[model samples]
Target: MKIAIVGTGQVAAALGKGWAARGHMVTFASREPGTERVQQLLADAGPNASAARVADAVGRSSIIVLAVPFTAVRERLEMAGDVGGKVLIDCTNPIAPGLRPMFDATTPGGATSGVEQIAVWAPRARLVKAFNTTGAENMAAPRYNGQPSTMFICGDDEVAKGATAQLAEELGFEVVDAGGLSAARHLENLALLWIHLARVNGMGRDIAFRLLRR
Candidate 1:
């Protein structure tokens, strides 16, 4: 399947490289028109991988992964044009600085849970929430450890979820069906727990979420 990654950052580059390793045709998109950074990043993605403007990238791909900073997500979507009728995967967790996940204390609602909010901007698009946790370094250099890193996904569309599951599996993660878009609230909150542990407890960047079944 054709995949378009809507960012040129570490997370986007890592996922794009992983997808290319899985033999999927992938493109990395950026807001800047003449981006040498994305061009250099695409070099790691191989010949099948290239960079394009966000709208053009979204228009050509079957799936779109938004891996930009959470703070920039809303405007990024707005600038990416109306991305309707596409499987838009939201990997953003609106984390601010010095605070918790959203980076702001006393925000009331869950922190870093901006996936659904972004989905509202693209009402006609099939939005799937995924890949918000874990540092980009871990994703790029996954240890595997004889177990799959749990990747929780939530969406209103089952078909879109299934497609995301396949992508997650290909990306070397064990997919967990976290139910509908409502589940995004918890996952977004989970980002805080992870951040707290990674930052306060010194758990390390290689740490990822997983569910233990008894």
Candidate 2:
């Protein structure tokens, strides 16, 4: 799989290293193409990975990962041309800084979740929300505590979600179907709880999410 990560942040860097380790053709892209961080990632990724412009990276990749902040997501999407007809994975949590509140199930219009906004942006792209539930450090590791972590994914397109789940499983996570893309709001907020856990306790990224059932 040719995967292009459209950010230089921790999430993108982690995915780049992990996917490259999985033998995927991975590229890390940055708005500033010649930045030291992008150069370092290219060197770190070795021959299997390279640095590219956002549009070029999105064009070449079978899957494009939006790992940037929630506020910056739309701008980045616009920068990546014709993201339609590709598997677009969004790992964003629309978190307002210092807003220690919970997720509002209703949209500002009080109708639906905010994830639908992405749908409006890339009508042709098959968007799935995954990897947002887990920490950045955990992404690079294939396993945790001798067990596989569960990656919960959701999207309107079943085929796209299927592909996303397969990729998650290939990356060594137990993929759990979490219904439609609207569920992404809830999933994104799930991070708040996880972050709170990290704050209240001393849990690190080595800890992963697992859904235990009867």
Candidate 3:
């Protein structure tokens, strides 16, 4: 798969490396693709990874991962031109100043959830909610105690969810289908809980959630 990562940050770089290692071409969409920092980051992801302008990157890839900060997502999506038919994966969580939940302020009541709100920004794209619940360290290495950590994903489109699930599994996660786009509310809350546990409670970044069954 040719994956276009819509950010040059840690999360994007980590996922880019993982996907590149898995033999998927990764193109990082950035404002300054000619910069040394962006070039170095792409180089680290391997030879299959490169950098391009936001719109150009999205135009060239089948899968688009929005790994940018929540506040910048809308602007970035707008810059990506018409991304109507692409598999757009939302990997951002609404975190406001002072580590507060930005959803209350930014997300309208009728939007249902952040992912749904994001869908409005990119209405034509098949949006999938994923990769926002854990830290970048956990994203880079999802295994602990010889077991893979669970990655919960949800979307209105089953095909989009399936593609995101396969990508997550390829990166060493136990993918869990967390139902439709409405489930993004709970998933975002889970992300806040994870942030609290890792940062406030000092559980650290090595910890991850696991689902067990009989």
Give the best candidate by lDDT: 3
Candidate 2: regions farther than 4 A off: 99-103, 109-114
TM-score pick, better of 2 and 3? 3
| Model 2 agreement with the true structure over 1-214: per-residue lDDT tens digits | 8988988889988888777877889877788878887888878876788878888998899898888887787888898899888999988777656734223644464424335677777878898988888888777775777788888889988988987887788778888899988787778777777776776567755677898889
The Cα error of candidate 1 at residue 29, in Å, is 0.9
| Deviation (Å) of 92 in candidate 1 | 0.6
Regions of model 1 farther than 4 Å from truth: 101-112, 141-143
Candidate 3, 67-132: lDDT as tens digits = 988889889988999989899999999876666666753456667567888888888899999999
Expressed as tens digits, the lDDT of each residue in 149-210 for candidate 1 is 78888989999999999988877788889999878878877877887888889887768887
Q: Tell me the lDDT of model 2 at 19.
A: 75
Q: Top model by TM-score, which number?
A: 3
Query: Poorest 10 consecutive residues of model 3 by lDDT?
Result: 104-113
